[model samples]
Target: EVAPQCRTASAAGFFAVAMYYQGADHASFRPLCPAIVEPQHYVREEPLFSSMAAGERRAVRRRRLGWFAHQVHQNSRTLIGGWVTGLFGAIATVPMVARILAPRLTSQIRESMGSLVRPPATELHLERLGNNPGSDPESMGYSLDEMSQIVVRILQDIGMVKDFPPTIVFFGHGSGSLNNPHESAYNCGACSGGRGGPNARAFAMMANDPRVRRRVSQLGIELPDEVRFVGAYHNTCNDDVDYYDLDLLPRSHRELFRGIESDIIETRARNAHERSRRFESAPLGLTPQEALEHVEERAEDLSQARPEYNHATNTLVTVGRRDWSRGLFMDRRAFVTEYDPAVDDKDGHILTRILQAAIPVCGGISLEYYFSTVDVEGYGCGSKLPHNVASMVGVMTGAASDLRPGLSQQMVEIHEPMRILFVIETTAEMLSRIIVENEGIRRMVEGNWVQLAIIDPSNSAIQRYVDGHFEPHLVSDMQLPTVQSSMRWYRGQRDHLGFATIQEPESDQPMNSSESNASAAGALA
Candidate 1:
């Protein structure tokens, strides 16, 4: 019946392809199948094969699998087999060997390491400047004035001194994953391999105090009585948020807090949907709610290999106002630190302090991903499947391999190895002075470890810094693709997406999945 239908077909570009081996007629019809099509019919247009050798007329160019493809096909099975074998062998032999020599080996191990002396643990000392009140260790705690200054410095650093929101949330981010050896590597680097929740909670507590607010007002900034500060910890792996000090919130502010919480829930669901595109295991057709559930499962799943691609594909770091790059889809690749140039002084002192934290932390993260992607086995800790936690400090390849550092193959799998580009919205002269004044910044910029570019705060004109001079970066005439929303652009795709101007709906009401898909399809058409 299919053969008769194929023979009677009258469509201009109709073709039939074979599937079964037992059908000889289907095999004969394969010659009519199209191998390529016009760009109008196909999603993309590119050559199927390329010349193996360059500048040679008679070079053979057969299609071959990529290195990553080959590894996925061959290396995965071998790694799993080796891991399983090692697991059972250790389980069978280790208990018996320990039982046989438990009494004797304990004495021998202690005697062999008798000369080792543990070093003294260092205690942190916080001393107030312009005061000679302390040779005593007991006077190291921060005073009320010092605490107020800290709050002022934080507000200045983030450029949020004025126009306080009714409900302000300070979110300290970290990761949560089970059965992962390098979990600490995914936490906030600014917190010295620890979660930043404590610091954020402390800051919020201090800022909310009436006494601290009075001191802050005296120092130059004032907080309104209606403004309430909330501290929250964000799990980057699962998109779960935990807010602190909820009981302390006033009854009048409960409704406002609920609204904020709802907004956060929606934001995390959208964020999870975006992250799901990078996970090969995640279905492209997943709804935002389903994507959230998928990531929550990955955090708890023991057999999962890639729990979260931490800091992967990070290439751009923007240090300026949020409005400069607002509505621009960075595809979760840029680390945005909000800073207003108008808030800074003529000497760019505020900008200097912002970059002092931004450059080192963001640059270090980018470099780590760069090196790990370039050489996964050498620079990275290899595959996470075979990793073993050693000494409760680091991960080893197996039971007795050397301690591995850097990122793992699972973490950097989707990463594109490149030096991070730092785009700062400031004048060239101010940035040049900062580079000269700061040695660390100078080394990173001059050594070509990270690329630098400055955008004019007044006109948004960009200048690329090269050889100690600023050159105007040429802008192309091409315009970015416009979409109704980010979900409309990113849905049903699993590759790296480009920048687009998101023209969201003017209404404050949210759209359901069906409405979103219909709008997206209209845009695509």
Candidate 2:
């Protein structure tokens, strides 16, 4: 009974080590009984060899570092003199280099580069204007016409051109923590690890303008006079939502805003409750309000290693209407983007724009988590327990070490390392064309860096893209458990919970006879 399982486990471990050594970047291993250990005789000797190999690699790394340090110490004077000379030479040639590159360094070029010489690289925490337009007038901000277009595009993209809500809240998300050097890791990736509140506030202010609204109406998407746009910031670490420009709110809209605020308060408590399940320090029996308070304290605590698991366990990105995924428990593992194919042109211009940002950003985040989780010491920055912020440049181990570029162990402790799955609401043909045309998207999909699937907008059917072709995915017949509320489903659980539908008392459906019989049989057994 256990021999096959032991063999499978050994093979899986061997394959994983082989894949790692061979540089098979995308390979993943799943053991049949990962938590169970076989008898010593049942285990294989391959893992011992792999461990020795790992030790050798570590020794090699240490030798290289030692050699560099020895050279630096022996030739300190020569190296320092050479560095000084080079610095001075570069300073002296700055005028010449600037003059030579003057023609190439145009205002348009600078604007395109986000007014910086180098592009924003999240690995180094460099800030950029991201996909959304920023408040910087010349470099990142947009004109009135551009803002109107953005408004229309947002509406059309989200399938909200008609039936506009009275008060539309644009919520920008960021994190809050005390005495955490890697605080930026918890902020919005779209904003280049900066607070996104300003972006949301700017967009809301622009959309609320009568002039922008007039132009948008001329473009065929009319906003009612009563419609108002409100900007808000969500502190993910503390689970708090704060509204901006409330003083500018109309007298008539006060009641509506108040109701929205109430709903947000309730949502914050529930969200905190869901997130609290992952924290060992948090009690499983905590109420929603208690969970909220617990998370709030975590944000403010100086000793909190994990203000929150930033992007951990992110497995999928779904680009489509909210209706398809509504009422489904996502377990906070999916990034949902609003896109309406019905409103898109045949050329899929809107979809293309969305993917241009979505594919790279989401894929980058997923890959970062994947690598960090797979080899925490080698790929990741290692444990942040002894990390020190060096001169505000980056994090270093102990007092001095190499600047760690990847995530910390606390951030990726619970992450499941796998290539991210991208589910888009579009036809297979459109997706194929997208994959073919966009070089970045092509490399990611074709190279198997990300898994692709298209969901039919008409019937909500899914077709996975595999080996350059779309294969229809078989829908499962298994039913998700039902509960009256999230608390009912999550109560007394301190580990990962499966999906369960929350329903009102009246709408809760009774289990079918077949499932009931199966349950009875299992219980009896």
Candidate 3:
């Protein structure tokens, strides 16, 4: 049913996606559903194979490259003397050779500076987030009746009935930057992109096991011996949170884990003053403790060129109920998935696994930021200001050609290339039998890549999806301006503004946004 001009992933919207790197289950990032099928073997069983192998499907060619093992532990005269010192135009001795041999190098000078930058990995010191013994994939780790039918089917795919949320706090997002080569495409795309802190420290050690909470209250779903599933780690690139099991949290839930870590350190300083209004050397109206110490020193600035705009204007993905995209404004551009579509009455079965994992993880992160912001030098892999992490798997520019995978150009230059609207709730005949029984959610609803819609999880009847059905997406009501916070409706505003009905959020006074103004031309769905 797709066809709003083939939805996007081409004509400069990128997604040539050929994906491999299977095993650690993100099962090769769906594009032609990993060449036909094996959607995590319908919820896991060590997928030795289900799809990917018609001579192993191909296409993601940006000159196939993948170095890291300490970037080919250098040789060939220390990789032609660091490409003849980046072509004799030394560029200010590359940040003083990236700050004094980036911490006393040697594993043979870190395989000669990890062949020109970015190699740090250590620190897993996991004291206890427990249940380790053989960490089963099938010697059968998941059976207390398969972890209570995978915790009552992910609490009926996020609708959650009988108990939880006194302190469920799974959070588990991830992404770090420095010399970013799409840092595992800024992680947590259902941990295929990886780092959802060991799947939220292994689902808070299998929902605080007492034999999986007595097989999740013998499947009636109750979980509350002073309910405590913490395991955190937000860092959705520098928004930084971290918790993880806190030695199995319960001294009667330590004052509800110190009031949910002071409302997540005041929502990570109002999400770093809404990502320091898209960082122009941050520091304006400061205080969310000076914009969380300027985004914890721009997540340790390796010549910081926007380290934290990781998902940059991600564009509305609402699965359902943050009571309908919360108090209006969503400039931290919505990916909100709570889901409650009346717990599936019309057989949408948790709205078809929340649109089969939010239509390829929010349409593969909005067609990989709308083809890396509509082509930043051939589907983006340009600009991280003269990138060179050539061997540590990807990114290459100064030290030769080829090996330029997507995302860069200062991370899709403020990114707004569109295509992901996705807004689901339920209906339109249970979303057209989940868009005619999934051919990978009908090739992302017939290649309009992602735009589908629905709304009414009992009221505001929106609709959208087109060319092959559903309609009424009209909008027009009024009473906008509300604020009391969003740092006083974007304190010292930078630009792109819209949607204001805030009514609470008070770091002295601020701003979903049917977002427009980042210099509006489109986006309303």
Candidate 4:
């Protein structure tokens, strides 16, 4: 019954064998069927798989295990290969992606953070002048008069001040001591008092002086309506002080002036604190605030007691805190003044000394004044004005050019019969210009000799010239004397000599085919 039930199962039926027999005459085989049992009994009975041979069971389990293992291995290999391919692809594309994104990212970051980045500090100092005892020109460790003279000379050399003087604006730093005991001492003389205080008196006097104005006018410099007077005040305690007169200078000079002033104040305070002796006494008597107040009062009294100098109306003072020990000192003034180039001794005074040294050999000069204490340290010698002044002058003069385009035109005319050579590279750009903007080129060409030469290395015309053993003329395209193929043929020379006299086109002569070929060959060559 069990055998029949097993044989009736689908698995048993599928596995049933069909036999084949071979004989001498003919042979045939038929399907072999197993015995069957009742379906009800087979359904009710549990199969005894343990009764099967161990080897057969083992074989079935091995096949199932092998199939599972094969599937796992195949899946792992596919996943690993895909991962590796993706990683490699990403690595290869990184550079291209970075190249596309980097500039845009950088620009965005710069735009976002631009306001936070500080400008580079200026290295310029204003020379100290007048009654303060410590206000020795040498003690500020810089010479202002010398710088002034140098500036004057530069202006003359640049032809900005031919016979007439230019209006000059001077900027200066303060030199005085701070008033607080806890505050550090500084050499900020100009900022000893409050805004519009005594240190600014001298400049005020100069600005208002009719004689000074008349003298300046004679030199050809016209002062603008708004006068600027910038001063650097030292910190009495910890390099923390409000700049009282930052508004004194014109808005144009504010950014640079503020940076310089701040740097000086910080440096001077830092140095003073570094050199100061620490207090050894115990705090048995006064509170910190009281002590601070007491020190500040004493400083204020001292500053008030000091004699004040009379300055011009336009002048404004920036005072350091009261605790500064260096006392009040006046910084140099920025004003428009003219010095006689022939009579001015560059070494005689601070102003003239700089002028003699700074005048360019070419004999014209222009200067921009950047007055700051930082400049004192870096440019302790006299190298301060040239670098900053040149840039300022360029800006100013460039503006002048915009105002009067006729200036360049007139200058061009003055240098006329100017043999301008418009050498076109014979590129697509050149061809386009000749074809599309031919009229403009014609106008330019009419004024000067237009030389058209094939620059494309692959061009037949260029190749022909190269083959002819003639060197191609290496003239600048935009330079004067535009030489074309026709001109070269007319000259009867393969190469145009440098700066030759202009020759008129001959009416009776026509270029022969041989000459044309020779010219083309020479150009190509």
TM-score for all models, in order of appearance: 0.71, 0.70, 0.28, 0.19
lDDT of 4 at 75: 58
Error of 3 at 475 (Å): 23
lDDT of 4 by residue, 1-525 (tens): 001100000011101111111111112221111111111100001112342354345445556666886875565468686676666666756544443345334334544664332221212112334323132333321133333332333233222333221112222222222221111012211121121111122232233334444554455544334333222222342223333234344565565444444444444433332212122121324433344433333233322211111111111111111111011111111111222223323332322222222121001111101111113222121221121112322211222221111111111111112121221222333343433333443433343222223334234233111221224555445343433222232232211133322233232345433222110000000
Compose the digit string of candidate 2's lDDT tens values, residues 1-525.
Answer: 101101000001110000001011112221111122111111111112324555445445656666887875566469686686565666756544443344224323434753222211111001123444332322233446766876776666556677565677777677877658888877766545555554455556667889889999999898988778776678888888877667778997787677557656877898898899999899888888999988877775555788898678998888887666655666778787777788899999989977776777678789989998999998999999999999878999998899998899999999999999989999999999988999988999999999999998878788999899999999786688877666777677765567777563331345432212110000000
CA deviation > 4 Å runs, candidate 1: 1-141, 509-525
Residues 1-525, candidate 1, lDDT per residue (tens digit)? 001100000000110110101111111111111122111110111111232123121211111223445665565479685676566656766534543345234334543563232111111122223343332334333455766876777777666777665666677667877667888778765544445544455566667878878999998999888777776678888889988678778886787677656766887898899999989889999998999988887776656778798688898988777666767788888877766788889999988876766677778889999998999999988898888888877888878899887899888988999999999989999999999999888888999889999999999899999888999999886589999788888888877788888873453446433222110000000
Q: Give the poorly placed runs of model 3, Cα more than 4 Å off.
A: 1-94, 97-178, 187-272, 276-300, 303-306, 309-316, 319-333, 336-358, 363-430, 442-454, 457-483, 488-525
Better structure of 3 and 4 per lDDT: 3
Specify the poorest-scoring 10-residue window by lDDT in model 2.
2-11
Best candidate (score: TM-score): 1
RMSD to the true structure for each prediction, in A, is: 24.0, 21.2, 22.8, 46.4
TM-score leaderboard ranking: 1, 2, 3, 4
**Poorly placed runs, candidate 2 (over 4 Å):** 1-141, 504-525
Task: For candidate 4, give the lDDT of residue 216.
Answer: 46
Instruction: Supply the TM-score for candidate 2.
Output: 0.70
Off by over 4 Å in 4: 1-197, 201-227, 232-245, 278-525
